[model samples]
Target: MGGFFTPDPPPPSPPPPPVIVTDPEAEAAQARQDAIARNRRGLAGTIATSETGLLQPSQGVGKSLLGE
Candidate 1:
């Protein structure tokens, strides 16, 4: 009588790739660029509001629009 036999198991998967080390200088440069971009947007918005006189103080404490 013939006997049943099992096939060999598949090979193990390859290991994952190694992690890369980031450069501090490059990170700092990117942060600086981001900050500059953010500042530019803020400055533009401030300028637009100031031009429209929206940036003036809301309250006139002990003061008047015209000479007292």
Candidate 2:
């Protein structure tokens, strides 16, 4: 009788939300560092793109646009 009333154990509760405790001071320091890094832009001398620009299999090296 109880098994009929239980209704499938409520679908397992969705795995809980992510827990993140951010530090204000650390966040501010990171922001400042990011600002300084932003000033130093790389590959400024030449334009870069992700596309290989070649139709055939043999072509020039493919360069990563974001360097990642």
Best-performing candidate as measured by TM-score? 1
| C-alpha local distance difference test of each model | 0.75, 0.64
lDDT of 1 at 65: 55
Residues 1-68 of candidate 2 have per-residue lDDT tens digits of 24866766454568878999999999999999997776675455234544343323654456646674
Global local distance difference test of model 2 = 0.64
TM-scores for candidates 1 onward, in order: 0.46, 0.42
Look at candidate 2 and give me any clashing residue pairs.
Answer: none
Global Cα RMSD, each model: 10.7, 10.5
Winner by lDDT: 1
Candidate 1 residues lying further than 4 Å off, grouped into runs, are 1-4, 43-68
Let me know the TM-score candidate 2 reaches against the reference structure: 0.42
Number of backbone collisions per candidate: 0, 0
> Which window of ten consecutive residues has the lowest lDDT sum in model 2?
45-54
- Candidate 2 error regions (>4 Å): 1-9, 42-68
lDDT for position 22 in model 1: 100
